[model samples]
Target: MDTTRSLVYIAFCAAVIAVLAQVMIPLPLVPITGQTLAIGLVVTLLGKKYGTQAVCLYIMLGAIGLPVFTAFSGGLGVLVGPTGGYIIGFIPTAMIIGLYFEKFGYTYVHAVIANIIGMFVTLLFGALWLKLFANLTWSAAFISGVLPFMIAGIVKACIAATVGLTLKRRLQQAKLLQIIQ
Candidate 1:
């Protein structure tokens, strides 16, 4: 892919993920959405450098009051909100996923493990932030912020992993991976 085309593609994926954030199924804690799955897919398809850049761009857009976050709310408040940890967690989550993809060839099993790990890392960061900034007890935080999302996260991870593996195979077969590289 040409530089311009690649950048455009990255921006498009970022926007799609941002839009997916709004399509939420409200849960006891944070609402569940397809954003994480999208993130995993983007990283797997785009590789580490561009994948991380795409997620960073998404974060920057959301932080700047672009309404790219869930419910079309953004700005500094969103970063400090109850779900802020998860929002902010996307940064390292993307980085970790990208790194994993680059370091290990994409296998369905490995992709599943990688996506699960990435989601767990996001949850860990989000939970910690909730405890520190929201003044929630560990038990309360876990109950309200992490536990409720566990099953959903697992499902999302599995779906993302499967999709990512499939896409990787297609890209390799089509020689699109070489163009992207």
Candidate 2:
């Protein structure tokens, strides 16, 4: 891809993440959002380079108060808040997913495995942050922050893997991402 195309793809993925993040089921401690699904899609479609770029751009935008986070929240405060770790965790999550696909090939099984691991990565970060930021015990954090989201995360991972791979194949067929791989 050319520099312009790369930039456009990165920006577009970041925007998609922001938009998907708005689709959430509010919980007491942490809300379940489509951001993870978007993350999976971004990495599956763009791979490590553009995927990581997009995640970083999205985080930076949110850190700068662009209303790109859950419920349209953003800024440094949001970054340092209890749910902030989950947002920050997107970086490694994308990297791992992209790396997995890069090494293992973009098979359905691999995508599902990568996404499930990514989900756990995000959950660990969120749970730890929730513990410290919320002044809760580790178990409390696990219960309130991580446990509630596991089943949903798994479902989203499957959805992301299935949809992401399908979209990637379609995009490649369309030549939209022909030069990417």
Candidate 3:
């Protein structure tokens, strides 16, 4: 892709992630949000390097007090807060999911698998951070953050995979992606 196109993709995905972050089912410890779905979509559409770049941009924007995070919240304080780990986790999650898509090509099943793995990555960071920041036991953290979200995460991930893979295929067919090998 050209420089302008690459930048557009990064900015567009970052905006999508920010927008999706707003849609969530609030839980006690964590909200079930479309952020992960957006993450999955970003990875499936953009692949490894660009996808990761886009997510990182999103994180940095939120971190720098862009009000781009959940509930219209953002700032360095947010990054160090209870939900910060989940925010930080977006990086590795995007990279892994993007890598899978880059290697395997865009397919619905693979997108689902990649997003599932990505959710685990988010859980790891989010759980650990929740435990430490909230001063809760590991099990408490898991119960609060991970346990309640597994089924929801899986269902949402499947939804993202369906949407993202379909869009990716359409974009590819339209020659929007270079698909250089």
Which predicted model would earn the best lDDT?
Answer: 2
Please give the distance, in angstroms, between residue 2's alpha carbon in candidate 3 and its true position after superposition: 0.7
lDDT of 1 at 126: 85
The order of the candidates by TM-score, greatest first, is 2, 3, 1
The residue-by-residue lDDT of candidate 2 on 16-133, one tens digit each, is 9999999999988789999998998889889988999999999999998999999999999999988898998999999998888889989999999999999999999999898988
RMSD vs true structure, all candidates: 1.7, 0.9, 1.4
Range of the 10 consecutive residues with the lowest summed lDDT in candidate 2: 172-181
Give the winner by lDDT: 2 or 3.
2
* Pairs that clash in candidate 2: none
C-alpha lDDT of residue 126 in model 2: 93
TM-score of 3: 0.95
The sequence of per-residue lDDT tens digits that candidate 1 reaches over residues 1-181 is 6788788868977987798788789876578877787888777777777777888898899889999988888898988988889878888998898777767867788788888988998889888988998899998888887888888888988988887777767877987666552
How does each model score on TM-score?
A: 0.91, 0.97, 0.95
Per-residue lDDT, model 3, residue 67, is 86
Candidate 1: TM-score? 0.91
Off by over 4 Å in 2: none
Q: Summing lDDT over every window of 10 consecutive residues in candidate 3, give the lowest-scoring window.
A: 172-181
Off by over 4 Å in 1: 175-181
lDDT of 3: 0.86
Q: Tens-digit lDDT track for model 3 on 39-70? A: 98888778888889989999999988998999
